[model samples]
Target: MTDLDAETEFLGEWGRFQQQTFFLLCLTVIPNAFTALSIVFVADTPPHRCLVPAHVNLSAAWRNSSIPLEEDSHGGGPRPSRCSRYRLGDIRNFSDGGLLPGVDVNLSTVATEGCVDGWEYDRTTYDSTISSEWNLVCDEGWKKPMSSSVVFCGYLLGALVSGQVADRFGRKIVLVVSIGAHSVFATILAFSSSWTMFCVIYFIVALAHTSRTGSAFVLGTEILSTRVRKIFSTVGGNMFFCVGYMLLPLAAFFIRGWRMLLLALALPSFLLLTLWWCVTESPRWLLSQGRAEEAEAIVRDAAKKNQIEPPAVIFGPSHNECKPERRKAHNICDLLRTRNIRWISLTLWVIWNTLTVAYYALSLNTSNVHGNKYLNCFLSAAVEIPAYILSWIMFRWCSRRRSLFSTLFMGGLFLLLTLLVPANLVHVAVALEMMGKFAVTTAFSIMYAYTVEVYPTVLRNTALGACSMASRIGSIVAPYAIYLRSYSISLPYILIGSLTVLSGLLSLLLPESNGMPLPDTITHMQDFPGCCKKTPYKLTQTEENEPAAEGKCPVVS
Candidate 1:
């Protein structure tokens, strides 16, 4: 065990203070879940057709027949064209002569034109969406995906900045400020008059949202003991996010308007700001900053809540004397300075990027599925419950590498199975998609704990932030990947599945960290057990003979 863990062992694991912090910190993720994937419902493009002007007088039958039939890109055979309509002048002349369209003139021979006036949307599913409000269809369809990409662009910036800020300041300050900022920006986004304005405000909201999420995860992990960290990281953290995910469809189902739904999602973030008083600053972070007195005060308070007597000297002489060394500033470059850490960082970047692409692609593709969009989205979020539970079980007993590899492989296999399911069995295809969601969700939950264990406390938040920034590249690509469904229905699934399996194969090279103590410094990092041999540090004969120097190497094996 690390010296810090040994010093704080008197409070026991799962005390009142730890339990309260875990619950409150996990609550912060709910708003993040709402804002992260709200684009699916906000920008949904419903069925639409060209508008027939009232000036061209015609019977209801003739007006209904104005649009020509075209082959459905989703494989439902010929359907009414969404972007074009029969030349209204010709149709009007035919109606005046009392001749019908298929009876006298062939629609195949009739010339078609783009919607000259405007478009009319089918409001059966959504009463109003950004696509319907701003007419983001036909030639304007590219704007819809661009809006989602803008949010992720903000995520990229936030990840790069938040990590360094939190590591330099403290976790609690960042969490409070981010939560408040997100709530304010999200409220202003509801009043957007144009698509350009909405995108700008939405970008700021996403930046704050990402900051809030990363800070909460880091704070919760630092505050809790090692034994309890696994539970809080996997089940406690992600399950709340699942709750918000499930709640989104229910809120959208009732509101049916994009603006009001955004307001609903935004208003709840104010409630999370109350956490500033209830949550305590992380003691580990304080000690790392060379504030031993502040760290001791928090630890003693935790002990008081647990009803245990506090030790007279909580930090001891070793921690007090070594304060100068622990206070040194570390940056992102520090993650690449060492050999084992460099290998781990590069591998994690690939794994994070691949998982993000697959996860968001499956999530956003819910609208393209055969069932009701609301029900499909709800099922997708609901399946995460069992996935998280299974993740907790694996973290309790299984090796981190094996658990990540198996879950990712299973997720890819289920996605690939969708190709074999026949078009006639729509239910089977939906089931396979849900199974893929379940497996990927499990792997995602396990990844947070595994990443935390691999890095030292000093660079933990920075490493996570950098990895998150890299993952935004995948998120930016995910919407376009879903756009591939326009060409072939199975195309998105095939791409996401292939990448997921490849990532699972790469994860085998990461060192196992299931039961190891949290590394306090870069020198204490764990080595790759089977893939790479550890290089021992050179020492003098007298120093090597000492018990403290006997097994101490620059890098642990």
Candidate 2:
């Protein structure tokens, strides 16, 4: 195969064609923002208490005393019990003589019972959520977290399947199919009559969304030149995701009902179908498959769009050219077949898991923050803008390993700081949480670019998929991590902070790939050096011209 970056050098890094393609790919990520975190609003649990029966003849003051106060879980003082009520029968009997409780009759002896008649929700914040409509609180409270976990489960399945399909079929087809499926299922999810039906459809939506996102990331990176690829991966991809996340809270604020909010989010995805006509397959991918004619045609069109004249032979004869009979088919198993690649893959999986857990744990915890839920969510999403910008700057000048390690360490440190914040200073706690989010968002953005560079093109998507699949283990644990806040306000922070710090230490073991050409084959990865030592392999004259040949070092010096 031709060195794809060198072969396409005539088109320039930021030509008209490259600019247009980058914009369209980034657009696909916006709707996915809504799909990934909309559960924050969809399953929100409003303040609620046991319902008082209308048949009980009692004054307003007497009715108010029917529900007993319980100790607040967060040390905020006594509040109304969510799942229990003082026995109404005892209250009614005590009030038969029109005697008030506490003064005339002792109410301490009264026993409490579960909310048998159902509960009444406080709809000040949300007009209606799945929690209020279906009563997913108390005994059925487990279902809310289960619903969030189901989405991550779908993500795990999508990562496992989409990588293989994209590698086999093509990136364009996978992107098209995944986006269309996500739109259809998300729209269908809005009209669900039962929670069971809703969860099943939501799972499919999550699966399709994950596939669409992975395919878009791989396609964007492959099509752009090495210099532009870093920009596209770090800033271009995640900035749009942040925009969609910010928009979600704004949309949910106006459309407080869950069904309508879902409809508003899903309907706009159909506009993305136009991408099929504008987006082309990755030239790098086509050449790797030995479809030189197709790759050349796309290259010529890009040259024409950029108003540059192409040479007589765009791709010269080279040793890297693909021979179908001689080429061994690559699969997920290939990731673990070698020593260097195996260790790299294992290290990446651990890093990905830690980032996923910390990132989602902070994002989902916005609802439980002390201020207005909408404001908290909007601020959380807004903080990612600067984080991504900082990531792009670091990618341009700093080492990938050092950038990742610094961000993870700082993020963990910020989260740990939350434990020392006084309970009375709610704003201080919120600020620390956002700072943690900012740092993790930066690390998460860097991880995307760094992982793509670590593997060869043949197994890039497959490796990314496998690593993504592993990260779902953390995402699966994230909702429950947030749930831990109910037990002790500090438990979630302790868990997330400790894991994040540990992952940063693990990242030091991987090799640095700054300014290195993307590896095209397993042989290329084998020749590459690790962060700590040099392989000291000899290269042919032709190999000397390759980009990866320039960056084999024993240490930073």
Candidate 3:
């Protein structure tokens, strides 16, 4: 019998054992959610202007009016210049002349100079953030978003090594180690004395955090039956991630300091350490590693907890055969060795990178979306709930490829619509952005499942690892995408929208996997309808080693 058949007999779908394990694993995603986007608050830049030095003898009105007004480079609104002030000497002279502040002082004619005295931040919303503490304003504005990019760079570095290490050292060990390391570093990140120190520590925190979350997700997924896999991934994992996202705004509302906020985000991981006692290793992983005895023991334990009797022979005899030849692992070269698989691999990478970039671009842009930052963040996260539900429903009722592409295109379309919205109608623009966010959220959920379905099992994990690394690269670039607002406010939306639509078009070139059995080999993968040459794929053992032919894609069945 196959692994799925054995899993059905031994564990049953959604049994008590599965539910318990899923819940424990899902709990871990909460803290991950907090850390992933905590930068939104931690590095937030509230309304600010150059500080009016106390030493300058100026009236309160003169002090307030001293900062010259300038046209916003991004949105063209009139606002006080963040990095400049009316020349201090001019203000000092005006005050010395006994002219009351705001009393016919042609402030526009006054010369302006770079702020010599740093800045004063509006504290009504946020008491303090990294942007305020480090004066990362004006000339230093890029550092705010770059801080996030630094974390994602760490994610890229970790993705490079974590999967191979997890596959070799076991998922549970890596998951636990990453969690501990993430927590420790995250705590240190809160106490950062300099922006450089924060970036360095945050990088390590991101690496450990991504590694832990990825391993936990995979471990939880591998142990579940196919019947509930989609639900667990979409509703359980993605929805729970949204829950953490939603909670961030609420937490920030009360805890206004950036250091305290980072502390809050970091502290939750310590609580996650408790799960090490409750969560079990993946039985599938054990079997793959040829530890059949441990695999059976886990299955039996699951059966007992599920209140079901195990069969006398819990595992098939094939599980006990230690074939050293079967231990050979496929590498990146294997994914590109075939024509159909290579095309599918490249297309999948595009979709992954596009979706991830667009998703993070929108997520990071919430602060600039013309609403209460906390409200915008909450609404942005809240939208993901319905998005995940729609994803779950779509996976159940629609073609995976169609739903995936449609959602991506629709998201792009909504973001594109934002450009036509009049600048005065900021509320309308924000609404459209939220709609785009909802669609992108749905597409993200669909893409995760669809990617797994596209590749053969032998190269599945490797393919996913590659795609995840691509995603991290996208994330690393996402901040700069959002930063484009410095040039034009519409640029970020236009860029993300255009790329998302292009990704939808690219997705259409790939085969649909709905209702199809997963391919087990490169030959089987190439044989899938719409992924092959006009001629049927039949590879002889010797021919199988050859590079796939280029430049042809069969029509979808």
Model 3, poorest ten-residue lDDT window? Answer: 548-557
Candidate 1 vs candidate 3, TM-score winner = 1
* Candidate 2 residue-wise lDDT at 399: 85
Please give each candidate's TM-score. 0.94, 0.95, 0.91
The residue-by-residue lDDT of candidate 3 on 389-503, one tens digit each, is: 9998998778776787799999999999999998788889988999999999999988877776666545555666677877888898998998898888889988999999999
Error of 2 at 486 (Å): 1.5
Whole-model lDDT, model 2: 0.86
lDDT ranking, high to low: 2, 1, 3
Cα RMSD (angstroms) for every candidate in the order listed: 3.5, 4.2, 5.3
Candidates in order have lDDT scores of 0.85, 0.86, 0.79
Q: Model 3, residue 331: what's the lDDT?
A: 71
Q: TM-score of model 2 relative to the true fold?
A: 0.95
Question: To one decimal, what is the Cα RMSD in angstroms of model 3 from the true structure?
Answer: 5.3
The list of candidate 2 runs beyond 4 A from truth reads 317-322, 526-529, 532-557
Candidate 3 TM-score versus the reference:
0.91
| Cα shift from native, residue 137, model 2 (Å) | 0.2
